[model samples]
Target chain A: MESFTIVSGTAAAIPLPNIDTDVIMPKQFLKGIDRSGLGEGAFHDLRFDAGGRERPDFILNRPGWRDAAFLVVGPNFGCGSSREHAVWGLKQRGVRALLGTSFAGIFFDNCARNGLLALTLDPATADALMEVAAGPEPARLTVDLTGCSIATADGRRWSFTIDAGRREALLHGRDHIATTLTRTGAIADFEAGHRMRTPWLP
Target chain B: MPSPEPLFPHAPDRQGPRTLYDKLLDAHTVCSLDGEERLLYVDLHVMNEYTSPQAFTGLREAGRRPWRPSAQLAVVDHVNPTAPQRTEDVADESAAGQIRYLRRNCADFGIELIDLMDPRQGIEHVVVPDLGLAQPGMTILCGDSHTTTYGAFGALGYGIGTSEVEHVLATQTVVHRRLAPMRVILDGIAGDGVGAKDLIMAVIASLGADGAAGHAVEFAGAAIRALGMEGRMTVCNMAVECGARVALIAPDAITADYVRSRPRAPSGADWERATALWARFHSDEDAHFLREVRFDAAAVRPLVTWGTSPDQAVAVDGTVPDPGTEIDPTRRRAMVRALEYMGLAPGTPVRDIAIDHAFIGSCTNARIEDLRAVAGVAKGRRVAPGVRGMIVPGSGAVRRQAEAEGIDRVLIAAGFEWRQPGCSMCLAMNDDVLPDGARCASSTNRNFEGRQGRGARTHLMSPALVAASAIAGRLCDPRDLP
Candidate 1:
């Protein structure tokens, strides 16, 4: 029910495919019912070893991407399980938006519901962006959802499209429940008509 | 152009168009059901190590036990270690505790438990169908949203919160609403190189992530029929992503064949009777749905996720879009933010993005078939330098079978790690994790922030794509390999 705008932080590039939900917020974290604290378990395997030591070679250990809020990935992002925790983890970790070639269906909905931006681009454009982002002195990609375009600090830009209804919801920070609630008048009217026609029960 | 005349023109006009919640109320007959109009006869209930402990606690607190233990199934998958077969090697005490709790709860409640050591033990979603526990014409509920995976068996499957879990445990039912039905009929044979993953991706792309919100989706047509049960599961598994309460495919010969061999399935005359019942369960030819959509299977390709949402996808060979010309500021901002997080620039080539790691394992695609697909790609091929990779099977049986087929040998020979069965690295619950700033090609789900590890950049792709990326040390199409 709450709405918030996401601001991109550092741009980190991970060009891979089939990143499943388990990797996003491993199964161990799933034990808890509360949505909070999942950020800690986000990518448990890649961050540590069998002995729980951190993997120094992982991208998250690198200084440049430590605070990255934007994730550039390959195709079929969020493909495996449909765990809303995955999205909650990402949002809690401050990832405001994701750029990939494709995504898993359930993970995509989680993103939209949580107010995260998931933008799809062609593979070629994604590759070029990864190159620029991996460079020194961090390149910035501006996500203006209301404007429906992505611009980089260097003036390069990309245009994307979304369903008008979804676009409106994102702009207004409304989820499906809120969208449905907006039709209260119609629902009330329907209930009234039903009462008159059937009138057997309250 | 002109909004394409509203995709479902007749949708609103058909009986005033009910929402999923509305349909659920009608199905349950909440208004007319006797005695407070509570839920009765739960369709399905799946439990995993992660969420079952607290549910058991709630049950005990209420001085109630499982009403119909036969309907519930529990499995230990999330916390089990992917390596070190000995249970003692489970490094995380918390996970070990949960596993123990699930085992005890199952024994106490008389619910079916697929323990780690059991040959049938595996990811709950994978093992359920593998064992024929899921069937057609059932209303299934699980603690996990991926329970929708069972929808492939022609049943309604969705996730339930812990409270609902307790409700089901005590009363064998829970309050519910029905979902408006959305029928998606695929018209043609899938072209070469396209798989169930691609088919689902195409569906999401066409409908957008929220297109099926509050609907129960029914997938029909030759394309869906042609898929094996495993393939069907992959397609239905992500129904939640499309915002549908569930996704289902009617039962058929394939379903019968798959279930007949399972240990739990009926035998001889019983099997025949069960099949008869299943046959009657299919939607009648004249059955109607609230909405209908059609697609050609031949148009789909091996897909990849370029954005955070499943609907934000493209064929593997495409490039990032330029957001400057976009009309919606919200979408434009999303694209820009996605590019930034992914370290991508506008107008960049997507194929050129490199990878540092490759992973294959998860409930979604870590079945035996998935393992075989990766093995096919990894055979006689070495992982690219600087790219670390691993393969975790969904179950102990899959692990044993892969080893029997020398798939492990091929993987290890190709420099891929062959670990034991457990949810590893996929969500970083255990010791598996990506190092800081290490970009990885993973076959698990969700490429959200820190999914692989803290600040670990993840790219979601199919198993074959993960294998291909592991070999190329970059995001390359599986079709482009070999």
Candidate 2:
């Protein structure tokens, strides 16, 4: 796993609530197990017309936010399903952190496990950020995971938080399995005690 | 931090010093009776095209055929390709190979296989229940996590890893640790537009994703009983979202009726015996659960996730909670990260956001009923300009039936692509995907990042809500459409 921090180059605004997994990565891409190349197919139906051409009217096709790294979205960002591929897709596409009002429980856990930061803020702050980023030139947002803060280029900063255990794991580039392995000694000690107390079975 | 006390304080003391899960294990006898070993006596095993090829290989390598072929069923659904017909144009070689392997294995073992060309072929979850292969009071295992969808029939349905799949194929049994029971009782009637999906979303939001880990959930009470089979399936399908081992609803008349019409369901006298057995599978009137939670069905509304996690959810009308107020600093950071990724401000009205795409499909909500609901909303309405939307039927049968009923026409007239049957756009499994940075309103389960594709943002909602969003090109309540 790659451990790194990200700064939003230009804020891409998607002011939509309850964006589900199917719309983010449609079921069609699930045919493959390989994690790469999915970013290009990210929003197949939305970005392209029936003829498989890019829909110029789509927000993703717009020139201003084409290279945007920060996404300002509506409430309930990852709402449907528990597919972990959603996180892999986002991470591969250079989405280091997500800013939303709320998220689905499983989706949030998946993000934390994959070292992706999913940030929650009050609606007023989200709206302000989205408005600024939706402007012509694309506003820059900074996300410092070590600092646990997000800020705009103008120095407007907002504090964020993460689960203490998860924060430690993410900062160290360790996943749950790694954390579990750290307790091997303790587990071994417990197993030895159990064996001593009950020796009837092999 | 110390693990919280076992949610069920009295469970260990109940039933003569053994919990229900313990009893189940002992009965299976795959392990020692003293709780030192594991045992399994699975009643049903389901396989899909994506994960069964390796399992068949394992079986072949072991020089053992399926021990109980009668208990096994296979289907080709996941990689059927969303083209106009079920053809060989599948984009993934592994998916195609898996399908071919499933066909070969089923033919060799005499296990039922629903081929993609077969009208009966659909998503494993949808096909199993629709064909009545899942019955009440049985233990069912599938290679897919969404197997919990069969719990609506009162069966203990859950997913297993690939190794477990091989074990089940060769021995017709799986070693499993029983789970404590959690009861989620619904009281009162569901309000209009509130369906099983909303109920499950509300429960997950309240319990958090890991709340029911190591537990088997029993959905009960008036509102639950009132749900149709399809609705109940939707509720049970997402049980894993809360980390529950499974979710089961007691077999009832509705379940029996749904099964009665299925081709594989027991017939005549056998049916009567099966029904009697199913009726006995309910928890005893005095049976105790490890944890009990009650919800007033009327309190649930069309809910959606605002962040990346299922637990970080709110009602459509609710605003985002400020992370600073979270009691746990660690959780506060998680909330903040979710917000940044989702790009929402706390206290902002969730309904005000605009949507770029809308999708309605997946095992969680792609049943015929779900299609009908979306068709009802799409009828006579055009998709909002610049909004991309698609309706993928769950199965070939559902697709044909919808066409017969003119539901497809309604969807087509609304400018939504009426795709062929399969798990289309629900996951980035096939060619379906959202462009990078595109946000969408979807009806499938799971909103994990890029579940659709890399850099794709997903918002979970009911099918009607998805349709409404498609029509409005943003998040809008279905009730407001008319």
Candidate 3:
């Protein structure tokens, strides 16, 4: 896990609503046994044409936004699948944060667990950020988890909210699996008692 | 952060009426980590090849094995070819690699796996519940979103990402957040030709795609009670489309009967004990629901998705919506793009839209009952020329049951192809794929753009409607037939 405190980078905007996980990481890239080199597969259809060539009109294909670290997106982004591959692909493609009005529940949770910041902002603020990112020159924004704020080069800033538990986990690169394994005794005790109460359970 | 001193061996007695979800959470809580999160125990952790590989790789990298391997069930469904011939061959090297990796990982970890060659192998959502692995008063987790289907049996089941999957594999527990409760009461009986698929589609369309977000939905009332176990599963399975993580129906005689006949179900005194516990699994009379919505089941008609999203659906007799009618600029723009992608005109009637393919399969509607319903529609009717109809059962058991009832013969005799089981053409991960720009009347869930294949158009409908559309070469309502 990578720790997150603050990151400043150019942002890209895809303003269409309901950009689901299928549109992010398509099904064709899910066959690999390991997670690596998925940056190419992130938004495969939108990034490429039928001939497998890059579509120049796509936001991520443009020169200033090709390697964007932040995404200013529309509401309900990452809606459909429970695939962690979608988050992994985004992170692999140099995406450090996503600014949206709202996100799908499971995908939002997936982003938090995988060290990607999914920020929920007011609709007006999100629209403003999208406009800023869509400009001719790349828009560089700074997201600071410690400050709970996002700011632009012009000194404009907006505050956001994140749950305390998740905030602490992200501040330090916490390994949830390692953290949970320390309570093995408690888990075993619960299982033993659970068996007695409902013995028929598998 | 709080210390781990509050860990208790048994569930604490609490006052007040509790929903089924609350009871399940209380019983499974290892400890409360925070105000919103708890270390909850998992009774069964189901897995599929597509999502389990990365988790296994993480486990191997960390030198960890599943704490309770016996409590896990792995199956190979996605990315497996669904050809009629029973061969273990997968031509796609990458997909074949995933299955091989899954088999090796399951064997090495001492976990039970229904491999591709096994007669019990099928979609995880269908195979697990059919084998009685998903029982009432239990907590189940899986890598696929449709794991909500197990909630039909009164289990608290939901989907998780690969990171959570690895955590569950390592600890047999997940750091879970409590969900707000929403109850949907369906009143009145469904009219003729309206089934569970139509009922759920109507709910999704009425509530919008994100209506149930951040909530655990409980389907209740007279209409839901009147439905059979198969119908309950259908309703719960599609609950995810409305953004619900968990969907539940309280256990009753219908659930008990379905579980009693399963191969792994308890018998004798154990069965009695299980049923007694299951009977007490319903929400209390005074249980508090954060939100409630009531619908008249009789008013629901056969629905077909007119646009890219499932909520963009309308009644079969309805016409496509014009984007000009939408006041919100963003929503109107989305509607216009969806109409473009679906190749539908705003004023065109849903029944007038022609389809090139008709698919009947997916975790949502490929059960024996669904197959039987489609068989009834295709029994004596021939598929319209130029419409390719295919039926892929949810699992090997469903395929065998359909064959025993001669459903395969009827469908095949009507110019339909009876294919082997797997998630064939639903997500198009396997050899079964719709051609680019092809429109399909499908029984599967998710009408997102390119769900069946790249640039493919899907109009989500029931098995009967799909069958009817195949016979008519368009999106025809089942009631319009005969």
Please give the DockQ score of every candidate, comma-separated: 0.08, 0.07, 0.80
Estimate the TM-score of every prediction: 0.69, 0.69, 0.98
Give the TM-score (vs. native) of candidate 2: 0.69
Q: Where does model 1 exceed 4 Å of error? A: A1-202, B1-40, B84-86
Model 2 in CAPRI terms: which quality?
Answer: incorrect
Write the number of the candidate with greater DockQ, choosing between 2 and 3. 3
Model 1 chain B lowest lDDT segment of ten: B29-38
What residue runs in model 3 are displaced by over 4 Å at the alpha carbon? Answer: B1-14
Q: Best lDDT goes to which candidate?
A: 3
Q: Over the stretch B67-167, how does candidate 2's per-residue lDDT look in tens digits?
A: 66877888877666786655656566767766777788899889988787787777888878777777775678887778888788877777764445766
* lDDT assessment of candidate 1: 0.70
Best model per DockQ: 3
**What's the residue-level lDDT of B118 in candidate 1?**
79
Deviation of model 3 at B272, angstroms: 1.5
Candidate 1, residues A1-202, lDDT tens digits: the string is 2353435467877665556676777665776634668888777766787579989866665777767778887566675555667777777877788887676555665677667788777777777777767756666777777677777877888777765645665777763433333444544444444334222211
lDDT of 1 by residue, B101-165 (tens): 88788888898888877777777877777666776645667767678887788666777645456
Q: On DockQ, who's better, 1 or 2?
A: 1
lDDT of 3 by residue, B1-482 (tens): 97743223334655678898888788789888877899999999999999999899999999998999988999999999988886989999999999999999999999999999999988889999779887888899999888899889899999999999999999999998989999999999999999999999999999888889889999998889998988999999999888898999999888888888788887889988788777778899999999999999999988889988888999999999999999988889899999999988899988899988999999999999999999889888999999999999999999999999999999999999888889889889888888789999999998888889999999999999999999999999866877
